[model samples]
Target: MRLVVARCEVTYTGRLSAYLPEAVRLLVFKADGSVLVHADSGGYKPLNWMTPPTVIEDGDGVIVVRKRAGRSEDRLEIRIGELLAEVEHELGEDSGLEKDGVERHLQEALAEQPDALEDGLRLVRREWPTEIGPVDLMCRDADDGWVAVEIKRVATIEAVEQLSRYLEVLRRDPTLEACRGVLAAASVKPQARTLCEARGLGCAEVDLGLLRGAREPELTLFEA
Candidate 1:
């Protein structure tokens, strides 16, 4: 990861036009050739970002970031006003993401009892393969419609985005045109819930203890 902080003006030109006036902001250059420009606020989402398969050219005092989509091209140019700081770190190879406790345990329990996520939901298979990656679970609803399940420890916007991608691919198949998506997690952030609802996806909060074979009455007794 390379972090650069500088006072710069950014201009984006492509399908749309955007401009970030001169200011002190953070620029992140990832090992994947992705670049992100971030303001001090706006939570975690960057002000502007260019995904991988991009090229970055750093001149004396200016930087040009460009990406090509299909036959069209998009470009982001950053004109440096002042150089603040720059640092790079050689983070070793990632061993791969480790699922959280809730994610692992909930997925296992849900696989054993698909109805735990939705009534009449029957498991077709776990880790259903796709070009991108394997879905957590693929199932059939009461109507036999395909349901793509993505289990997360804590549902966030990224989780919803991932499920959306899976649904896009699955729905492309004529046999699964009626396929839908469900995001099951221990808890869901408001933003995530809103995005899922807007995308016509279903959201369910799984009961960790119940899925683990704990009696509900015992939970109530413990709560009391």
Candidate 2:
């Protein structure tokens, strides 16, 4: 990650135009290919920012970040007026949040009663193998089609991406060529839901209370 405190001007052009005239601000260029411009007073929010999967072009006193937004492009241009302070840090690979007691218990419950996530879901295996990592559960649906499941207490965009990666690897086999993915979690975040919907991945939020025989489980399975 690179951090710079500078007097700079920022302009964003995409669906909307935003301009920040010359001012002293904090600039962050993350290793994940994201860029952010922050003003001292905005608390945590950046004055301008761009998410990952971006193209960055840096030149003398100027940096531009570009991302594809449908047919057009979203761009952020930073023109440095004066460089105040600069620093770069090598942050190691992130150790992501773990599945706690609740998540583990949720997995055990779902594994025991796979139908609680989707009507036709039948457990085939747990810790299904792949090159990248293990899938939480592998199952067969009503039609006996393979379904790869990733269990999380709170599913995020990362979870959706993880399931996507698993599906990419699982679909290589002729027998599992049609294998799909489902993210079963206690809670699914909205952003993750949107990504899953766009990618044609399944997102199911299981109510532990309802799944534990508190009430008859009515699962809504996404058909891919």
Q: Among these predicted structures, which one has the highest TM-score?
A: 1
Q: Across residues 196-219, which tens digit of lDDT does each residue of candidate 1 receive? A: 999999999888887876866343
lDDT of 1 at 14: 88
- Listed in order, each prediction's TM-score against the native is 0.68, 0.57
Pairs clashing in candidate 1? Answer: none
Scanning candidate 1 in windows of ten residues, the lowest lDDT window is 215-224
Q: Write candidate 2's Cα lDDT for 63-114 as tens digits.
A: 9899886578999999999999999999997655566987988888999999
Q: Tell me the whole-model lDDT of each prediction, alpha carbons only.
A: 0.89, 0.88
- The positional error of residue 32 in candidate 1, measured at the CA in angstroms, is 1.8
The list of candidate 1 runs beyond 4 A from truth reads 68-73, 114-148, 161-181, 210-213, 216-224
